[model samples]
Target: MSTTTSETGARVVPIPPPLYYAAALVGGVLLDRVFPLAAAHPALRVAGLVIACAGAGSAAAGVLAVIRHRTTIVPHRPVATLITTGVYRVSRNPMYLGLALLVPGLGLLIGTWWPLVLLPLTLLAVTRLVIAPEERYLRQRFPDEYDAYRARVRRWL
Candidate 1:
C-alpha cells in the first residue's frame, strides 16, 4: 500500500489515516448495534460535543495553515511545503490528533462505546501505516528543517 504513488513520485502512504478513522467509526457503529454499549451519562454526551468541536477546530487550523503556506493537503500526494506555523507549532500531526478526538467524541455523541474502544488500535495503525512513512519522507526531503521542526514540536498534543 505504501507503494500506491511511488517513492520518487509523491511519497504517499498505502492507506490514508482518515480512512483508518472512518473505518473505526463504521466498525464501532456496527459493533454498537450488536453490543449496544451506550455512552450512558449525559455529561459524557456533552463532553463528546466539546471534544468533537475541539478536534474539528484543530484539524481546520492545520488545514488553514497548509492553505496559507500553499501546500498540498492530501497525504496521498506530494507535500510541496513543510509547514511549521499556526497549529503546526503545537503539534506536528494536528489533523491526525483531530481525528483521534473526533472519532470517540462522535461515538459518545451517538451514545456508543465501541469507537472509543477502537481508537487506540486505529491510532496504532495510523502511526505505523501513515505517519511513520510521512515522517521519513519529510526527513528525506527537508533534512535539517524537518529535524529542527520535529525537535521543536510534539507529534500529538
Candidate 2:
C-alpha cells in the first residue's frame, strides 16, 4: 500500500510503525493469554521493565531529534532533513529498533514466552514491510547524505 503526496509525490509506506507495534502487542497478549506460560521470575520482570523503558527512551530521543531538526515524523512524508544525531547516530532506525525491543520486553513483563517467540516476526515485518521502503525513499531522496549515514550507522543497534 502507498499514499500520495502532492508535495513530495507518493509515499511507499502504507501502514505506519505504530500500527505494527500495536498489532504485535495485541497479538502477543492474546497468544500469551490463550496459551499461558509459566510466570516470569520477579528479577526477569524487573529486567524487562528496565529494557522496555530504555527502548521507549530511545524512541522518544529519536523523535525529539527529528522534531529538533524540524523534519516530518510521518514515514510517508518527504523528509526535511536527515537526522544523524542522538539515538539516530546509534541506529539508523531507532524508532523501529525501539519497537522491536518492546516486543520481547513486553513479553517478559507479562511473564509469557509467546511474545519473545514472536519478536523476530515483528522485526521481520518491520524490516521488510516498513524499513526497506523507507531506506529506498531515503536513498532516492537524499542519495549522498543517506549513503554516508547508512555506511556509518547500523540499521538497528
lDDT of each: 0.85, 0.79
Query: How well does model 1 score by local distance difference test?
Result: 0.85
Best by lDDT: 1
Question: What's the distance in Å from true for residue 116, model 2?
Answer: 1.4
State residue 6's C-alpha deviation in candidate 1, in Å.
12
Worst 10 residues of 1 by lDDT: 1-10
Winning candidate number (TM-score)? 1
List TM-score per model, in order.
Answer: 0.91, 0.90
TM-score of 2: 0.90
lDDT per residue (tens digit) for residues 5-49 in model 2: 324622455877877776777787888778886456998898789
Determine which window of 10 residues in candidate 2 has minimal summed lDDT: 3-12
RMSD of each: 3.4, 3.1
Query: Number of clashing residue pairs in every model?
Result: 1, 0
